[model samples]
Target: MMPRPLLLGFLAIVVLAVLWISNPAVAFAAGLVIALWQKQVDLPHISTVSRYALQGGIVLLGFGIQASQLWTLTTQFAWIVTLYIGVVIILGLLGARLLRMAATEGQLITGGTAICGGTAVVTLAPIIGAKPAQTGAVLGIIFLLNAFALLSFPTIGQALDLNQTQFGLWAALAIHDTASVVATAQIYGDEAA
Candidate 1:
C-alpha cells in the first residue's frame, strides 16, 4: 500500500485535475477525499482563510446589486419569503421531532435553512444562548448541505433549462449559504449572479 504522504500527493494531482475540469460535482468529491486522506489538514488556518474569503466575496457581491433594486426585490419577495420561511421552520421542527434531534439542533437547522444558512443560526444561537456544541453541529450541517447544493445545482439548472432570473431566484431561495448561491448562480451565468 502507498504511504500516506504519497497518497496525499496523488490526491493533490487529482484535485488539480478536478479544478481544471471545472465540474463542481467532481470538485466536491475530490475535496472530500483530500480532506479525509490528507493528514496535515491545518484545519484552523483553513477555517480562518475560508471564513475571511467567504466574507470578502459576500461583500464584493453586494457591490453588484444596487440598494434600490434590492428594495424592489424585498418588496416583491417579502410576504412569500416570510410564509416560506415559516413553513420550512415548521417542517424542519416536525422532521427533527421525528428524528429525535435536540430542540437546539432543530431550531438551528430550521433557522439555517429557512433564513440565510449559517448566518441565521450563528446570530440566533447567541441571542438564544445555545451551547457551543449545538452551534458547531448546526454550522457543520449547514456547510455540508451547502457543499451538496454547490455540487449539483448547476447541472440541475442546465438540465431544467432555467433562465437566469429563474435560476437566480431558485438559488436564492433554495441554497443555504450566500457563497453557495453566488457560486452556483455564477456558474449558471453572470445574469443569474
Candidate 2:
C-alpha cells in the first residue's frame, strides 16, 4: 500500500473522477474503503466531512425549490404529485418489509426516499436505534440508487421523448435524493425547473 497521505491524495482524485462521471455513489463507496484501509485518514474526520457535505448539499438544494411556483404546480397537477408520493411511500414500505429490515431501517429508508438522501438517513438512523450494519446497508443501497438515478434519468427522459417540464416533474418526484434530482432536472435544461 502507498503511504497514507499518498493514498488519501489518490482517493481524492478518484472521487473527482467519479463525480465527473456522475457516479458519486461510487465515489462515496470508494471513500469508505479508503478510510477503512487507511485509518490515518481518520474515520471520524471522514464521517464529519461527509456530514458537512450533506448539510451543505441540502442547503444548496433549497435553490431548486420555487415556493411561488409550487402553488401553481400543485393546483395544476395535484393528482400527479399525490400519486407519486403514494407510490414512493408504498414502495419504501415494501422494500423495508421484504428486506426484513428493522424499524429504524424502515424509517431511514422512507425518510431518505421522501426527503433528502444521506442527510435524512444520517439523522434518523440513530433515532430509530438501527443496527449499524442495517443502516450501513441502507446507505449503500441509497447511494447505488442515487447513482443510477443521476446517470440514467436523463436518458429515460430523452428516450421517452418527454418535454422539459414533464422530465423535471418526473425527476423531482422519482429520484432518491435532492442533489441527484436537481442534477437530472438540469440535464433536461435550465427551463426544467
Clashing pairs in model 1, backbone N/Cα/C closer than 3 A: none
The per-residue C-alpha lDDT of model 1 at residue 104 equals 84
- lDDT (Cα atoms) of all candidates against the true structure: 0.84, 0.75
- Over 24-60, each residue of candidate 2 has an lDDT whose tens digit, in order, gives 4455466567668766554347668867886797677
Q: All candidates' TM-scores?
A: 0.74, 0.64
Residue-level lDDT tens digits of model 1 in 87-140? 999999999999999888888898899999989999989887899999999999
Task: Quickly count the clashes in candidate 1.
Answer: 0
Candidate number of the best TM-score: 1
